[model samples]
Target: MDVQEAVFLALDLTGTFVFAVSGVLLAARRGFDITGGLVLGLMTGIGGGMIRDVLLDRVPNALGQPIYLAPPLIATLLIYLIGKHVSRARIWIVTFDAIGLAIFSVTGTTIALGAEANYPAALLMGALTACGGGLMRDAVASEDPAIFIGTDLYLIPALFGAGLTILAEVTGLLGGVVSLVIAAAAFGFRMLAWKLQWRVPQPMRQWSYRETGRRMKKLPSVFRKPD
Candidate 1:
């Protein structure tokens, strides 16, 4: 295969493994059976790519290539065989998820650009590709996803990766090396965010009557009047 094809394959494999581990960890946490674990693993591995392809108006790559599915299947088996034997499942889950996010963000941007999509669309596609699998996994596992909660810096890394890819393309530096560097930078950012407990701050909305009443007594006249 050529360099581009090889890069794509690497991204696919890396994403598959990361997402598979995420699914497996969730299944283990929920005490799912082996079959359930396998199903979740498969969904997590290909869910994002499937969504990306559908949005891009193409057949899903995972469906067309056995390579895309096999690594995840192997991962499922490994998780099943080792089931909670060596280390903390949560740590594994987070590590794999971070890797998957980085890989998918870069790969999705590359694919979108290859399809001749505009920069904004490419960035959106990349973010979706990074988060879609985790969304599916959370929905299947009946848990709230971090994206909506603003608890984790999940989407930021994806955005950074996508933005970097677009910047690289605009600057005429979008080769495999540059792409990989961008992906790695995104991954590093995510790791740092996780370590630092980075969070997207939620905006404070206007206080409701109850809150207003509670605090109104303490405020000066200028600020106390209702709209």
Candidate 2:
């Protein structure tokens, strides 16, 4: 592989390892056994890329090349062996997850652009590739996925990085340094959001049984007309 390609691959693997660590840590925190931790780690490391590949109508790199599986496996085993000694597991999980999110955002957008996808499609792919893994991990663990629940500004940082990557690529400014800067910016933004507890706005009107009942009471009056 060329040097540029090699660098991206290295970044991708780094992201995979960090994401795996996040998932394994989460499993440990939730009282899962080693087997469960391994399963969750693998899902969180590779599920996003698999989803991206499927969307792009290509074979998943993780499945097509066995080497793609190594980082997650290593991470799972390492965490399983030393989990008891790890303090501040939650903080570590969030930090690692943010790193993975940032790296994957860049790599995914690059891959989509290479596939000849348009800008919007590339952006969507990038966000998905960063997020799908964590969603899968949460699903397996039976927890509400953080991205959808408005727990923090998760997807926004991914999008911000992806957007910057796209801008750089289109402007012919994309390089190792640029990519690293974009990823770092994204990571910083995510961490900032976490520290601030920033959240996406909820629906202006929340629907609930009580609201529905109140509306129903008004509904009959509208049907009765001019009594």
Candidate 3:
């Protein structure tokens, strides 16, 4: 493989490994058995890519090439062996998950672009590649998906990385250095959001007749009802 291809492969595998670690850690935190951990880890490692590949009408790398499965298996084994000594499993899970998020955001976009997808599709694919696995992991573990929770930044950073990748590719500025920068930017954004406890804005209250009335009263007389 060419240097660029090799780099992307490394980043992809790294993402898979980190995602697997996060999944296994979540299983451990939930007091799941080894079998549960293994399944969760594999889900988190390959689920997103599988989703992307299927959507793009290609066979999943993990399915077509058995080697793509190695990272998660190794990650599961390592965590099972050493997980008992690690405290704060949740923290590690979030951290490694962030790393995977960054990597997948970029690599996924690249894959979509390589597949000749348009810009919008590439952007969405990047996010799916970064988040599909986590969504599945949470569903399997019976936890709320962090992407939907909006407790801290999640989807935004993935989009940011994906957008940046698209911009770089379009501008002919994409390179190994640029790719790394994009991933770093994504990772930093996620970490900062976590550190600051940033959250996506939610509706202040459920929409209802009372809320409608209150809003109506706040409007200017011209815009309010004659009554």
Candidate 4:
């Protein structure tokens, strides 16, 4: 493989391990069995990339290559071995997840642009790749994914990372050193957001009386017209 391909593979492996650890921790919190934990871990590691590949019209590397699956399996085993002895599994999981998000955001943006996608589509792909695994994990665990809830700056870092990659590509600076710097900046922003408890405001809508009445009227259509 060429240098770029090698770098891509390395990033994929690192992201997979990070995501897998996050999933394993969630599984432990939910009291899942060992098999369930492994399944969840594997899903978390490969889920985002699978989505990105499907969108980009390519076969997911995670399925075609053993290297992609092996890291998560190893991570699952490690988490299992450590079990509860790890004093700060949650903190470590969050840290790794942020790093993975940063890496995958850049990777997704680069891949999308390499496939000749438009800037907007490439940015969307990066956001999806960065946040998709966490969304799936939250869904499986019966929790709302933070990305959708505006609970944190989860999507912001991904956007920044993708933007940087896109800018670099446009400026003819899509080199390894530039990409690494962009990824580091993205990860640093994420860490800062976490440390500062940065959150987007969730606006609550006030229901109009007319709107409430319309909803009330519609609700009785299948209940004998409410007598």
Judged by whole-model lDDT over C-alpha atoms, candidate 4 comes out at 0.83
What are the per-residue Cα lDDT tens digits for candidate 2 across 38-147? 89999999999999999999899898878789988898899988989998998998899999999999999998998899999999999999998998998888877879
Residue by residue across 23-55, what tens digits does model 3's lDDT show? 999999999988899999999999999999999
Which 10 successive residues of model 2 have the least lDDT summed? 213-222
Tell me each candidate's RMSD, in Å, in order. Answer: 5.4, 4.8, 5.6, 4.2
Query: Candidate 4 on 75-96: residue-level lDDT in tens?
Result: 7888888878867766776787
How big is the positional error of residue 90 in model 1, measured in Å on the Cα after superposition?
0.8
* Pairs that clash in candidate 1: none
Rank order by lDDT, top first? 3, 2, 1, 4
Candidate 2: misplaced stretches above 4 Å? Answer: 206-227
Tens-digit lDDT string for candidate 1 (56-104): 9988888887778887788888988897694788777878888888888
TM-score of each: 0.87, 0.89, 0.90, 0.86
The predicted structure with the larger TM-score, 2 or 4, is: 2
Query: For each candidate, what is the lDDT?
Result: 0.84, 0.90, 0.92, 0.83
